[model samples]
Target: MIESWVINDDSPVPVSSAGVVEALRSRIDSGQLETWLTSSSGRLLAFVTNAERAMVVLLEGEGGPGEHAVDPGAAGSSDGFVLSNGQGDEYPDEDTVPIREAFRLVEHIVGTGSWPADARWVVDR
Candidate 1:
């Protein structure tokens, strides 16, 4: 299970399910462009946008290929929606899931130390 998480690369801190949810909400409601969450071990990471979308990435270890969450339908649609990484970097909407969906994905990792199987994912080349 995930013992701690770092927000936007800050010092790692112990985390609870409720705390996670609260942080996400606070970031979104505050109109922040984005917020990042990374596990203490650095295996799990997530980037959430103010638009209520998030992209989660899982790393096997150093030099290992990373897997990122994907929404197949959204990815294929021509909605022109985009997500930003809060650093002037932008990505296609297909690379992220709604924040509502993110809660489950993050909670799963916190509880099982694994990404949920139900969501679609694409591995970094």
Candidate 2:
């Protein structure tokens, strides 16, 4: 199980189901744009957003492949969506989901320490 989560590289806090959900909600509601959840086991879930669209990336271990939740039917003419931090990072529009979905994904990973099988994922090679 996940022992704790760090928000935006801040000091770590004990992980609780409600805490995780509230953190995500507060981030979105406040338009923080960039927040990261790091598990005690070294797993990292990076959340970046443009307010309406968000990306949740799951990294399993040190140098392990990263998996991203994707919206299978989302189509766009542009190359990808940009999620700006210091230097901007881009993810395919299809790889971005609604903020609510991001909340669900983060909650599942934090609560169970595993990915939810219901969503489509693109794994890094």
Candidate 3:
């Protein structure tokens, strides 16, 4: 099954990619976030919403991370439609990379500080 964490976090941290991931993990570990989406076997998406901004982050069963912005209210419908499309969006674009590759980069960044500063800003996963 695919597990997803969704939370509303607006902490003031350095504006960096690592900061983002840290925030996510912190929220999850603090029990301030809950699983907003769940599945047995497919793409998992989590929608994080706050008063000023919202984000939809997705992790494929065998892929890495892809995130995009979403309307606070449309997250549910958007995730539903994506899942209904057979594990991929019917209308994919060039802004995102494959999940495995992204995850590999994330791992390297965490271990050696080789940041994947170029990971695409995905519109859909």
Best by lDDT: 2
Q: State which candidate has the highest TM-score.
A: 2
Better of 1 and 3 by lDDT: 1
Clashing pairs in 2: none
Between 2 and 3, whose lDDT is larger? 2
Model 3 bad stretches (over 4 Å): 1-35, 70-125
**Tens digits of per-residue lDDT for model 2 on 1-125?**
33666674555556576677787667667756677777787888888776666788888765788988888988862222334344555566787887778878888887787678897778977
Predicted candidate 3 versus true structure: per-residue lDDT over 1-125, tens digit per residue: 22222222343232243444555455544543322332333444453322122234555543655454222222322121123123423212222223344333433333333334654344443
Q: Cα lDDT for residue 114, model 2?
A: 67
The alpha-carbon lDDT assigned to residue 64 of candidate 3 equals: 57
Query: Please, what is the TM-score per model?
Result: 0.70, 0.79, 0.26
lDDT of residue 110 for candidate 1: 63
Over 4 Å off, model 2 = 1-3, 77-84, 88-90
Cα lDDT listed for each candidate: 0.64, 0.72, 0.36
Error of 3 at 121 (Å): 6.8
* lDDT of each residue in 1-125, candidate 1, tens digit only: 43566565444675665577677666666666455566667665655553556666766655667888887767532222234433444456788777678777876766567778897889897
Q: Could you tell me the lDDT of residue 36 within candidate 3?
A: 31
Q: Output the TM-score of candidate 3.
A: 0.26
Kindly report which residue stretches of model 1 are placed more than 4 angstroms away from their true locations once superposed: 1-3, 8-11, 61-64, 75-86
